[model samples]
Target: MNTPNPDTPNRDPSDDDLDHTVRPHDPADASSAPQRRFDAEVIPLRPADDDAPVHKDEDARAADIDTSFEVQLDPEPGAGPEPVDDGIGYLLDDPDGDAYPVIPENLRTLGGVGEAIARHTRRFAHRIAFHAVRTPRYGVLALLWSVVGVWRLGNRQLAWWWVSEQDYLRSLAVASGDSREWYRLHREVKETRRVRGLILAGQAFGVLAALLVMVSVAPWWAWAAVAAVGVPWLAHLGRPEDHPIIVPAMTVPRFRLLNHDVVLRAYYAAGLGHPDKPNQQVTFETTMSRTKEGQGSQVKVVLPHGKGFDAAVNAKKELASGLDVAPSQVYLTHDPSSHRRHTLTVMDRDPLAIPAGKTPLLDCKPRNIWQPAPFGLDEHSRKVTLSLLWISILIGAQPRKGKTFAARLLALYAALDARVRISVVDGKNSPDWNKFAMVAYHFIRGTVPNRAGDPVRQLIDALAEIKRHIIDTNEFLSTLSPEECPEGKLTEELCRKYPKRLFIWMLVMEEFQNYFELPDQDDNKQVAELLSFILAVGPSSGVILLSSSQKPSGVGAGDVQRLFNRYRDNHAVRFALRCGNRNVSDAILGGDAYSEGFDASALPVGKPYLGVGYLYGATDHTPTVRTHLADHGDAEKILTAARQLRERAGTLTGYAAGQDTTTPDRDVLADVLAVFGSDPGLHWNELADRLAGQIGDRWADVTADAISAQCRDLGVPSVDVKRAGVTRKGCRKQAVQAAADTAAAS
Candidate 1:
């Protein structure tokens, strides 16, 4: 019924001819209806057997060169002048040697759950804004017409003035003379504005006219419209449908314009092209395949914020009807209000989405997704329980995944709890731990003892002392009186008066792998022994070991078995971040467990899964716990509190205390004096020999390194080692005899 306006010379893009060319659907079919989306027309599939070979190099791509020189070979013919075996191989091979398909550049995959949420939110906002405001198609036409009108008027005036100006004036004089001619000059402008205003006025008048017609014939039109609307509505209600209104809307385009506009906006923002064409629309819904149960299809749509809710619903119904999916499956939400701001409302088709007693996992409230069944708290209680019971947690993620933020949250949890004692050792010198320095009981920054000083050696030595303390404590407790048993004697009153075990002690090693690995089995075994001892008995002694690593390859699993003989029994937990290594998840959480549950690989930053060993009926259960690292205020409070407690104690206990608790037999002073009296460059072998009778060989390396590194860091020049021997100056006079002997020997 629409026609081009003669008054307007130019046509707006919206009024221009739409491309409706239909391509052959499926070649095999030779007869299928052509489908259109936005602007791109998709032909129906002909169902031809698509066994065609993909075009590629006939010869398989040449094999890649091995980086290792162990199997060097002569170069093949044309192998790039002997030194290179054809540069082509290097270009094709993956540098990391991973075989998985590379992520395509054009796909625009979401970075994480956070980015996913951000992405959907942005789309939602953009759609809402777009749907609320319409571009003026008529204004564009009006401007073009005005230009043509001016040109035509100018030509007419020019011709009249040249042909017979006086005669034309005479003719015009009969009807107001030159004034009439002058008025003609402004006629185009006046007429153009008049036409535009009429067009604008027509819209209101048309609405009023339509309403009047409806009222005048209300009895008749109402029945017919209801019949039309009801037919589609009943069909959709009766059967799963994608767009019941598709047939009706096609016939009633004018009435369905608002619905189409909203749908277009939603789909365009989502990158899901409008169903009518290929390009996306700001407000439209897209179709996903049906569920396994064949309940209905998964529908995604965005309803811009502040837009009429009814319009959005109508669009959703249209799309849902066409897809043959339930109306409830269609999601309607807001779009990104601006370029950066995003919003999303996802409706799900699964019945189990909202498990019993659990809150729906949605970014915004007022659940948009529909699940057949409702969930309760019982669905998530097991995980919630684990998070509360375990105080200090260690998290590891591949870079940029959210490990540090999660750690900070966990630290915050400890601070908020008030009873947990937490310490963090950031081995990588990352800036993450710097902000929480205040709340951490012990916040160690940079590599401990420096890279040159060898922090690994220092940590191993420290763990040795903690192990010794455990053994001694166990022995002492074993000999206690019946009334002095753990239940009666291991009280806070007893602990406050003593140095340790008043509260639970947790040592969080950010990258624990650094300490666990050693150059030789002996060193490795010693470190393992220390770790096993802690893991086995620390729980009883009020200590918990929480360590994090990128991968769990070199952690003390084998050692845990050998030493504790409790391989699976020890409660050492692990959490992997998007690891390709399936073995890790299987080893920690049982076989194929992560497959069904939350994928740790897909974990967003600031979120992590907690794996526990059969503690809360979790037979290798790995439950996700939101990691909340300690904030600045809480970190400060914890650190300040620890500092005050340590200040009152007036000493650094646990190995650094210099109490000689681990040494036996001879006085440790004799060994120090023996080293000091010798020549300046005493070789370690010779020093070990001198202290042989007093100190065992096992203790030699540990003791010498500990004493030497400590002294050098403290700036004490008591004993100096050189290539030749050892030297001593500013020696404590109390070691005179041993120093004189060393001086005489040198």
Candidate 2:
């Protein structure tokens, strides 16, 4: 149970009553059931037969006469005008369209066609080799079965010619003492045997004739061919039905096309419709058809009048069960034309197994950070791209599910652009992020000190530097002319002109949740504040924040917890891979994604499913992406090239350049308490005078105003204190001691 973030001064007082995290209890009562998720609330279905509910018109609701069109408007509006109909009795605004494209979407691009060919080639070669390896065994089985087939065929012919079954029937009649039946059976058997004997003799003569022709006119190879064909036939006949001499090297599953009956039955079984009820059965507004690639079947389904897409989505698992397929194979994409309409695509096989192949970065070519980077492919084989500019990305998953790899991928993308300054911070101190140090300006690992200096202090320094840079960039942009900065934001041209000043900065934090729960309360809060501030205002300043967390919830208590949740939820884009449960998935992707039925926890389980997840808030379609794999070698190679690019561009600095980025001693907390002495409290002027007197040269420039602001940043509160019967603002020794202890513990 998480609470909403603390309100700012601008928040409405009345809005305080809206406690979204919990249910409203009766004023006179104390307890209430735990808050229910909106999706869990059962929606009442209007199963009665009724007319279709009218939908709101889009064009009517749109404000068409905006600034560009206001002066050139053809008409004005008080209430929206009625929709005009064409002469042929159709509303021109509404057009019938097919979701399927003319060309196979995956084949529209050269890469897609090449990938398809390569995939098929790989599959074909595998099948060929698989069968080739088992050829000798197959031949041995055929020869063994053929020898038995010869004796079996001869015995069957002999029995047919001798009328063996007729003799048995005659004996049975004789035992029953039926003379008439025995006489009839004997007459039929005698006649049948005579006819069968003549036919058998003719078949032998035919065989002899065929052999003589093969021995004379036919070549030796022709006889071999005949034997080859005849041997397999004999083997087939001798073998049991279950056992075959030859078997398929690969299994190809067959899928039935989705027609009206199949689609309707699935919906009815899922309780979305009633087949026997009048006007309550699910119907298809458009004809059923195969997907562009012919890999699956798709249909335009419309639920009963009262039921919308929600009903179908909520019952998606049930629908998959009813259709006898895995839930991952069933995709329900909402149709924008109608609330009742949604497209259902049922795959023939598990789609998660489809490989996204390696990353395009394998070529080690530089990519523009402004353009969307090639991330991976969706379940439908559509390419998914990630836009790194002006957006903060959050990656969350259970440990060992490729959470670190996902964040590393984005960092590697930004690194390719030489102008992007990179900072790599690995809280868990894993080797997965080690390669990133090649391109990072500031690289820090774990909480303890390393060759890179103290990790915790270095991280604080990196964040503070980024925070200051953001403010500087904003101030510079504010002073720019419209011609210099058209969108009133950082642009590629501007950054290029002044690379050092405007170049993009990317901060990669792996296992960031560990920082939030640091043993030191003040350090935890300081890190949270700096990160929260940077995340809220960094993007417009060309700052990119990429944070990965295995534990996104329950990191700390009170303000730290609230800030962590707020910061985690505020990311512009989130990619969750193999979350432990729906709650974890929701925590990563937000509840809106879960409501839309894209649960990361539902991702197929297997080694192949690793690094694959639900990518939401990045594009219009929420795609389950199989992220492009970048192994350790790949990361090293790509990042080495990135380091060279930065060197060539004269963009290398900070840790990469071995510069001394150490900040001066910032133990302001310890200094403040030293000045306080044994006083219960003091005015700002009194504290500053005592610090100057006692601390010597260190506090020579310290002033009442300077110490007042510094104390706030150090987490020490100032208060009105009385000294010699005069009251002014200052801090007490008790508060300073607690602050120092908290910082020391972390």
Candidate 3:
């Protein structure tokens, strides 16, 4: 309501005598110059009185205009200034909320209750026995500490009294402001002194009474009780909290309790969670202690949304660092129940620090080849078995890494099965497999040279023989009705029905790379092709090929390398021990397998970890395993046992059967004649059928044409004969006798 000042800046002009529209002064009009234009100002107009007189002069109206209006410029139009961000605080919330469950460290697994009880009892007994052995020393230390405690009792009590008196004097100083309170404190302090004297007198009297009882009326057994219980208790009270009087001989690793905070911290440290977001939402399901000889803890974790076990496994090193443990001491495995869940095992010590003991195959019940054979113990010290029925195994590692030993384990188990026939080719020609020759149906020591031919040629011939076995087995399988082989593959029922006819043939080729890179290109190519064929088709026909090599890739021979890759692909089960680098690990396991964390190159290289390796393609998760060690003595014992079992069952055949070693070069005429005994008059078709049934499956390709050509080469003549209802081309008794005589003379 007050009138505005014209001299003030930024002030609105008075409404009286205000013009609604004011234009700029025209340069042509001199009188317009004195009239100020207030175009920038917006003023309200007031209605004039009804009786007011009107003035027509423009100069008079313009002289009342105010000049306080000024134009205010605005900023240029463009992108607006970015908003000031006070960062989101919810993202930094603590991840250890009650929303997630807490898993204990002793109740994770649901099955194997019996095994768990047995393991716990063993550990408890061992710990008690270990501590009991040193009880005498601990007892002596306890007695010495008790005597020292009695000597220091008086000094300790006096020091305690002096400290208490000092505290009381400080309280008196605080209450010095009030004269009445100061006098009251003096009386209280005198009473405290009297009470302290009475407590010290009682302690002295108690000690005197105990000594008097021990020397006079108390029994000798009472003294023993005091020494056993009283001494140790007193010693414990005198010892410091952090530093115990007695130190344990072994250093036991302490596992961090599995709780929400520990798990979230681990997830964040492993880079699986972001600081700008809530810690990866995890559900701690349950936990279990390792039910084995080793000391460790197991935690089952259900990962956050959109996460998987592979991510957890890939961050294994980070997790171990977060938990303040070694990488070898932590193990991450997938949960069988859910894809989003995983089991995290943290060990107190490396399980591979000790060599694996002998297997229990000799003591347990006999296992058929159809069932998985126990190979070794996994990283968690759980039994690991492998199925050889429909799979081939390729073992690769550096020298002295237990490549031969692993292969021998497979062969030994196969020999124990009465229905399984083993063929061992020790390419190194070492005595490692010499004992196996006792039980192997077809055993060839490649270390020894063949006097009559090239060694490589002999090796090639041995492989060819295996290929022939595959063809024969296939033919025999074709003759069986669908009822016998429902899946058109070898079954255990069929194996038991005709144990001699349908055998599980296992071929163990040690140093197999040598055969594939032979100097003779022809032999190398032939051996490669035969081995590839056997690996591809042998499993279905009950044939297993276990091959070991020091080098897995980059062989000088192109054909050999190609064959190696082919075999590697077909070998569904593979084990790689302490390799030199990632390249060798990937080559043996598979591309990306090493990156996926199944790194054999990470295995420790020493006698204790000699048989340690990463076993892949055998289960859903890759596991570090220590294969059982079976020395020469163990091998001989196993072979002797297996041979005796085979002899009792009448299942031994081939070279193991003690047959003529010269049968490899004998003509078909002599073999057929041997089957004939006395009767030699038989048709060619009849001869072929008899050979097929007698020689198992190797002679399945013996047709009438093959028979007539071989008979003519052996100087055996064929004549027309009448049999049954028609005359057919057949051999006469006289002609067969002449051919046998000629073969012997040669």
Candidate 4:
């Protein structure tokens, strides 16, 4: 057998080569010729190449053979070649490369145009109406001043000429030049003199023409028209280009013109823009109108990428500095319609510097109790109202910081509505709530001496009464059909339809923390539990609970603090005025509210800002509001007016109806005498029915057993008597008269 050279690429094969490539066949056993051929077929033997390159180096020849075989094994047909990895160049050419984002210009402006027109029209009408109604004396003085202005027109023109000539002469004196400058200055002076003469002549001719027209018109009203038109014309002529002749009475905020450059510069100053990177530009959508009162400019800004609304809000002080205004004058707010967009309002003046004046509650027309009541003005001088429909309120502040005042304002507003029934629980027992007692269905105070001589008992009793009221209200609401009370919430229609049953019920608990932090743990827990239930479910049934606290955190004993937190959470409307810390603000407004910029702790301390607080949950943004000032005299007047309104509407009920309690000072003995009034024998059942009829539906369940219990407590005697052919257990007129005499003597 011969062996073949494996490295040879072009060696011709002989029979020996073929025998070497094929497997050796064993013929000694000799199964058959067919078996021998089958063994030959089992081996695949390739023929040696006929024309292939030969190399002196065997290693090189073997490499060539391997390369030629690989070339012959081509890729699958129509399969494209693999992509080559070009180092770093592929990344440079990628279509999805990272770069600065481009902001598209906002071109939709027709809506803005309509809004501007509407705002200006409203402002104009308001100004006209205000001047017409409130300043008749000023208007007359202005008219007289206008007549004087016309008489001084010539003098004003002479004054203007003199000023102009002085300015020209000063410029000439400052000039440094040679002979050429002297000739130029002389020619300029000559031209200036000529112009001044022409202006004076024109003014004289205008006055003469006006006099001629006035003489020709010669009517009773023509003199008035001359004063009106001539005065303004002369005033315009005398006025400096930059200043108005007559100063406006109101302090108007002067806003700078808004442009792209100003907006970009503001962003840069606010640290929202990168100085090194010029591409990080604030994109302006469009410039909105100045505010209705001409206080500020509203600009829509699309912030740079990766920036959020909170960043813009936090940078409000810097933005104000950039705009050259006070921090309070600049308002930065997010535009909810777009994520990258925000609104920049730069005011010329601080709106809060000026007092918001008294609340507009008196000026407001009679409104539905479900609608929002005007509480005060916001930071923008826009009216801020609070909807009292289906919401409980939690107001917290440090002492003497307007917590009680704010609570009273809300209560007073509610009192104005004939359909609203008020209950005032004044733990402070100040005279602040004395007038409210005349209108409140339940007025509980420390001044009302109870058996224990403790105000906490009165507070607990008020809470219990409110809880009972809630149950009654819910039961009444449940009986109404869905069509009448949709969404199971109180509506104005419901109040009107069931005036006796569905009137608005408000419970104002002032210094509420005092009640919860009582020494008696049982009383504290009971009060907290009652408040939690009322806060949770009373709103939907036309029942509102407004509570004020000096300390809202850790207020009660044990789980009572947790109960207070629960109550605070349930209160949908919250106000915090001059809190000592952020924790108090958050406790009243909710956690993170202070961090989010609804911080009442930042309010100023003192009487001027007494009722000012941060109000949340009533509007899209938190607003600082100064509640109405209702002093003792104001309260009396309001109470008197409200009482009359309620009386006319026939909605007055409860304590306002002059009910007497079971105490010695205010026992029911006098009322019993008034009811019996020399009538010999009034049955217990008859007296109970009569008392129920007088006290309204809240006490409609008064029964003979209850009347007897009350009489026993008050030391009044009952006896069986015969009257009009009937005999039953009853009280004699003499017995009731004697009890009343005894109570009066005591």
Candidate 5:
């Protein structure tokens, strides 16, 4: 086999030995359409360039797993060719590949099952309504067109009986001045017309007899069935050739079910191969098959020998054109097997356009923070989740594209898990994040006071606390023996055991750039430095930072800007929702994402596609997700449930409990109310113990009688509380809450 180096910039003349070889195409199989070829036999094999990057030594070439391109097999007829590559490959047995999964991918997870049901159900119901609304129109058109069909059918039969075509023939004979010939032609025409007219009358009589029987002796259903078939036939024939009686109820989804022929044709049309030139024809590295989720098709494609993967990547648009699908429907994933190899996936429909619907957490179930949070559905309708442990996330997009909503959705998931401590900070003073305060330990709206005091200073102090917490938590974990803490990491059990000391902190910053553009340059730099440090080290210590920004670029001057850039780029996971440009999308998802064919800017625009974006660095597959939506009303509901869970577990603390977190507080009513939570009442002893543990040093030495006395002085009443087996004197939760509210109102 002769090979030429595409990188060498020059061709070798010795490679043209078979230039005159002409492969023939059979004329009998010619098609009306010139571009689509369906030849059953393979094109005659030419010299196989196969695949060689700089003509590797025979030994290395022999190790390649794919050997489908063997050249002139059995060089001599029925004789084995001379051995190359040390002849070692002959003795080696290939390893068996892993078997395909027994169960389908979508049915493997409960979330996946739910997503599939919801997606298909919505689609089916929409189609039902679409056709139902247009039924009246269809009925009217059928009746009108059938009348036209009756007239047309009679006219066509009359034309046939009259033998109208031979009238021209009779005239021609008359014009030639042949009276005998004209008479003969006229007689022949009359004979043909007589036979045709008789046949036509018989057909008309048969139809009338059928109708008469259907209307008289036949069942009523039989007459209806005749009308059903007969009416459609008339409508189809009588309607204008350019128009149709029935219109499509919906725009049919584009793209075809993929097969080898379909994939090969796409590559060929994209200039990756030539149908006639066997040497230049693209070859498949793997069979094209349905993806695991059964929503799309995937195949490992190797461009013709000399071409590299970039050749296919650069011609992506042409490839989509060939497949006749939107460019967004084509996904290209690079394969590590070889540079010439890349996986091509073409979806049956544009996945990004499929809406994922509302968040499942709307049910308000208490979720486990240790597991991955349900984020959205992927291109395959598989649930895409985000694991917040040991990793942080960044959300980036233009305004009104659901950037804030995407970030808040994750925070809400964390909120539902009672063990997770949350801090909500909105730099732009947006009301969207205000409801999160119900579950947030530290809530800040803006630089100035809107909901919380001195938002910048409060956030700075919160960061400082988080940094201290990270150090303290790490030190505590180091002290535990391997038996107690085997992995030197936070666990769900441990977080439950010591909810106050080792917290699962989630810091949500919405439109965070405003913090770095504050009037005080020093404050801007300070905020930037603190957040950057937290983003770097907090995740490992159980603090997950979720920062969202509409303006990810052009924030501050000098070090502040540099620090901001570092903070923006360091997140382990990034979700970009409809960014303004490719640069912004790259900034959010990173530079490599666009190369792999994911650009948030290229996503379809419109309200329906809101919350749809590329979720990168979160999973191995960077899927374009339609993130679950939780509007303000839904957010309030979920967050209220989260707060209730925390109150029941005795984990509510800081601002959410009305504690003066910036300084020390000794407010007994607020403290007991925070510890009281969802219980109707708590015995003084239980309340005292819970307060001591949850509120830390402030209540460490407080006694049951002391708290009871404090509650009574604040105009709170005592009530009878049932215990394990006996009744005890306890303060009612409502009484403490009323006292706290009264004090605040005063």
Candidate 6:
């Protein structure tokens, strides 16, 4: 086929033309010079006046010359048209004539040059037509109103020259011959309006009136008036030079375009773009993409300013309305200017929610006293129900996971609920549980009593008591018909009459493995019964089981499975914090639920996962992760209140018997008896004088002891210790008893 002429009009060239056109001086250039040269076909593209320079001769020469002798056709479509440069560089392999540049003047020859300019300009203008009009409308109106007002106020006249006086306004004021001098005059005018005018006016007025006496006083008042007006004007003018216009008053067209460009750039980057740029308001869509799997894309709209906060909030509200999710799930934040740049992030999850009017009980960090238990439990009712009904719950956490805090919160919650009664079995006597001792019906620090003592018997007795209480309460509930009980709340009278029966009792065993796994085999058997009672009948009697294991598997899978079985069908509430074993998490609820319940990747030092129905298939709601024991102080306060209650109720007898260990000394008794042996009754003042050295100032202690151990035992009925207050009669009875004891011993 004949070679297509690259210079021929309407003749498209091949790739060979493009490759050869870029080479330097060659044989083809010389050979083509004599035959058909492509030089005449070369099109020299011109740059705009403000754009970069173009070297036409060099480019043309480069287009015609070829390095090899073998001929190659022009790669570009030389004859058909010219190409367009869109800022983005063009690819050489384009098949469409759209890539070819059309000659500018030639286009006018074919059509109208004016039309193209007008068309492009119209398109560009229309692209921002609404914005251009909308953005400046408010400012333009405000400026127009100001101008009209100034015109109406005769402000122009105030600066106009008076022909009658042959004086321009400048003639009365000051004059500057040149532009530089005019600016200098501006300084003087400012000072005149601000500071010197009134004084000069007053001096001139004084001269006109010939009133020397009034000059200073009038000037002072005039100056004050000028200052009052000028200061406000200056204040109005005081602002950053770049931001000279007031907010809501000034319009920033360029900045707005910049903002628009930025938004568009972000949208494009996020793969969101509008087909029509003109005639439509900018559309903002979420950046999140949806996929086939449950995992989907989400958009995080970063608001630019305070106004942006309102936008974000509104956007979230609109989304929530559309999505049917609560507004709380919508997170609005001040994002970095770029992903890398800002530290100031203000976020509002719920913009419309009013704070509930209750103080948290534990009132722990961030959480209030009444705030739901962190780690897992969220509702007091659920925690109380579990305590009231569950046999045992195993709380396993790594250290500092707020396990103790959760326990304390649970205890406080039980204390607050009248239907539930709590008793703690702590081996370490963590100070957190001490306060609960008063309100807790039974607080056993191991069955051993004090540390190092035998806790096995004490624990067994307490467990037995707890079992008795559980059985009794269930029996009582069995007796009452649904009609007899309006609400299930048990009152103190009900508990008093049926001490073991009226309420649901919670027995919290801390470090239970220590007690249950005791060295003594008999003690171990006792623990087995305790566990059996909790595992078997506790749930039926409103006895919920809550225990903690450092290792659940270590406790035996049978027990774990048993617990799983009990709670699997009906677990009311369950929570765990920083669990080490994934198996445990799976065992509790399942790996999926654990992962869903807790953002384990983001867990802080003490945060925990709470699954509502994890222990028992109770509810499908995602468990709210919370820290344990909202506030330790609330636990202490409850214990204190319980102590006060016990004290008021004369439970003092129990406490007194528990701590009453004072015994009289045998020697002191013998000495007191020596003084009173001669007389059954004696003068009290005389006896005090005689025995002051023996008993010190606390002689009443001696007297009281004598009355209690001596006089009462001797049957000295006539000499009543309360009425006669006879120290001598009581001492005589002690002397008789002591002498008798001495003779018996000898």
Candidate number with the higher TM-score (2 or 6): 2
lDDT by residue for model 5 over 1-746, one digit each (tens)?
Answer: 32222223466655533322222343333333233323232223233353423334544333331232223321222322344445654665433222567876766889879977999999889888987888999889988988999899888888888888888888888889999999898888889988988898888799899878777899878878888999999988788887777677568755586788888888998988897886897878788787766678888887777887767777888998988888878888777677778889888888877788889999999998888988898777777888888888889888899988889889999999888888888888878988877878888887876544567767766776776788889999899889988998988787777766777899998888899898766677667877887888899899998989888888898988999999999999999999888888888899888777677887878887889888889767788888888899999999999999999988888889887665344788877878877888889889989997999656654456656766777898877889786789888888888888899999
Q: Looking at candidate 4, what is the lDDT of residue 264?
A: 76
Can you write out model 2's per-residue Cα lDDT over 603-631, one digit (the tens) per residue? 77888788889898997778888899888
Report clashes for each candidate as comma-separated counts: 86, 0, 3, 0, 0, 51
lDDT of the structure predicted as candidate 4: 0.69
How well does candidate 5 match the true structure in TM-score terms? 0.64
lDDT by residue (282-377, candidate 1, tens digit) is 443444433222332333444344433334433554544543334433434333333211222222332212222212221111111111111112
Q: Please give, for residues 578-597, the per-residue lDDT of candidate 3 as tens digits.
A: 89987888888998685455
Highest lDDT model number: 2
Q: Which 10 residues in a row give candidate 3 its minimum summed lDDT?
A: 70-79
Candidate 1 stretches greater than 4 Å from native: 1-394, 412-423, 435-454, 479-502, 518-523, 554-569, 587-599, 602-622, 629-746
Residue 9 of model 3, lDDT score? 71
TM-score of each: 0.37, 0.70, 0.65, 0.56, 0.64, 0.39
Query: What does the lDDT come to for candidate 1?
Result: 0.42
**List of clashing residue pairs for candidate 2:** none
The segments of candidate 5 whose C-alpha lies over 4 angstroms from its true place after superposition are 1-104, 107-140, 159-237, 240-248, 254-327, 344-350, 449-452, 516-533, 551-566, 578-587, 590-609, 665-746
> What is the number of residue pairs that collide in model 2?
0
Assess candidate 3 and give its lDDT. 0.71
Reference-based TM-score, model 1: 0.37
- Global local distance difference test of model 5: 0.79
Where in model 3 is the C-alpha error above 4 Å? 1-133, 155-168, 171-183, 199-214, 239-251, 256-323, 330-356, 362-365, 447-454, 556-560, 592-596, 603-608, 656-663, 666-746
What lDDT does the true structure give each of the candidates?
0.42, 0.80, 0.71, 0.69, 0.79, 0.44
Model 4 lDDT per residue over 422-530, tens place: 8888877788898987777777775346753555545555665666667777787778788877767667777778776666788888877777776556566767787
